[model samples]
Target: MNTVATPSEVTKGKHQIDLIDGSFTASEAQDLVVPMLTKKINFHQIKRMSLFEKNHKDTCAPDRDRILELEEAKATVEDIFLQAKIEGKKVKMHSTIHITLED
Candidate 1:
């Protein structure tokens, strides 16, 4: 039988299941310590962070370091777009401009 698991299950070595298939499960932080004591599994705190998290602590990075990350994201997007365009898929980016009136 297909079972659905919350992120906690994954970190805990429990049954495997896909959440995309329509199972609802939630994880709590309190459950983690039992596995830490008995399971001997190595787990990091990153799983606790939301998928959409953008940690801004990187401003401390040197000037060149940040630009390299920006450039890589740009290159990856450009490569995917070029392939999509060649495959006859429609790719469009919409933008809006805001105007400010003089006081």
Candidate 2:
């Protein structure tokens, strides 16, 4: 599952987004858009490891971490577009995802 930030104003099981026309591929998002956003936001740097020392417990940690972030962002974008298309709402760039629990 993907994750995105939830706005304080929005209650549970609600979402908000701005809608716009056009679509792009995950590669485009990962390479062009995500880099820009991460740079702008100043994401944390991956720690360096020495040759003798074992770095991450997971061998694919670096790639896995980055891919996860990209996937989540992609999911958010897909969700926003899907909502706009289905609901005919004018949302773009940003949106919320809500989760519900059944009793």
Candidate 3:
């Protein structure tokens, strides 16, 4: 089968969001994963740049660090996709985003 991604609607006061849970072919997995990672990386990059512009220095260390981490994750994901593509395998992926209210 192809990729099936069913995103659940967020309920009131819900802390967890089900983003994707499905099986996907290698190409489908790459299509689904790469864009998400790219978007997240772009977000952090923009945030970091904005902070730097505002402060005239590298003020968003956390965002910078997160961008690096996401880049590494993207690389690892690419490797997994490459292996799956070579092996003619499908990948089962489940992703959830959790929101927390912190003091």
Candidate 4:
């Protein structure tokens, strides 16, 4: 796990955090990313359910949209892993999380 960060480049009340950046084997990439995506999907699903239960009129549109987006990302990752396996090559992955104050 390699992390790259530049404190000087960050603005006040905002931060960019490097989560994962490295080359990994096919199985390793799957193990790292698939579960994360699944967890995100599950998180949105639960949030949607909670909102719906709290108010029957609530559509949970944002949560539904996010779940779809995450599912597509997971599928793309799976395809990349499959292709890497066929080619017998390692996969390069990079991810970052950004945080900022609302007000």
Candidate 5:
């Protein structure tokens, strides 16, 4: 008794059949609670955040105040990114920029 599950069943918190002999079997199905972790993240924009934090912590050897400052900076950057997203603008990070004024 091989059965195939529909996308709706898989997505809508419905019980799914187990695979038997590479085919899903309804008779072998059991009511199961799927473990899922949902997080609000856009990896495309903030993929390097982990590395940034890791390197900063490791290299900077931050004291408590410095750590707090780092955390605040991270929050500020996130807020800027969110605001820019809402305003339909792109944000680019640059390591260094030189500006000069000619009078």
Candidate 6:
């Protein structure tokens, strides 16, 4: 396997992000936009990592009718990473991966 630079939050099952090799191609960067970030937050990061964004009660839709919006947002994030193949840029889990897991 290529030398992996996992992020602080990478774990075996807690979550996983299967991303494209952006370094291999730049056009693939467009694949990083998750649908939820665009439909809800109106912006999504171009990344290929299993990073989770806690949904703030305050930012939820004012309509208050879309209970699934959060999950959809998460799916969108997942889609962006998966389709883009943009795995975490650098190696992770080698440093303080659990230095603050309890915090």
Better of 1 and 2 by lDDT: 2
lDDT of 1 by residue, 14-94 (tens): 242222222111221113222332322111123223221565443423333444554555455556555655675544433
Q: Distance from true position, residue 35, model 3, in Å? A: 0.3
Residues 1-103 of candidate 5: C-alpha lDDT, one tens digit per residue = 7667576654554243332223212221111101110111223124345555767554332243444555565566556656765676645432332333334
TM for candidate 1 is 0.29
Query: Which of 3 and 6 is ahead in lDDT?
Result: 3
- Highest lDDT against the true fold, candidate: 4
- Measured over all alpha carbons after superposition, the RMSD of each candidate to the real structure, in angstroms, is 21.0, 11.6, 5.8, 4.0, 22.3, 13.4
Q: Which portions of model 3 show Cα errors greater than 4 Å?
A: 1-12, 100-103
Question: What shift in Å separates residue 22 of candidate 6 from its native position after superposition?
Answer: 14
lDDT of 3 at 19: 83
Question: Could you tell me which residue pairs clash in candidate 3?
Answer: none
RMSD (CA, Å), candidate 4 to true, equals 4.0
Among the numbered candidates, top TM-score falls to 4
Error of 6 at 5 (Å): 34
Q: Which ten residues in a row are the worst by lDDT in model 4?
A: 2-11
**In candidate 6, what are the lDDT values of residues 1-103, reduced to their tens digit?**
7567477534433533444332422233333334423554332221211123353333434333343565575675456545545554421211112222232
lDDT of 4 by residue, 1-103 (tens): 7565566544457777788899999999999999999999999999999999999999999999999999999999999999999999999989999998565
Judge candidate 4 at residue 77 and give its lDDT.
Answer: 94
lDDT of each: 0.38, 0.48, 0.87, 0.93, 0.39, 0.39
Structural similarity to truth (TM-score) of each candidate: 0.29, 0.32, 0.79, 0.83, 0.33, 0.22
Clash pairs detected, candidate 6: 5-90, 5-91, 5-92, 6-91, 6-92, 19-85, 20-85, 20-86, 48-86
Across 2-103, the per-residue lDDT of candidate 2 in tens digits comes to: 467556433455454433234544443334444554553333233223311454454555644665676677567666556656665644233243455334
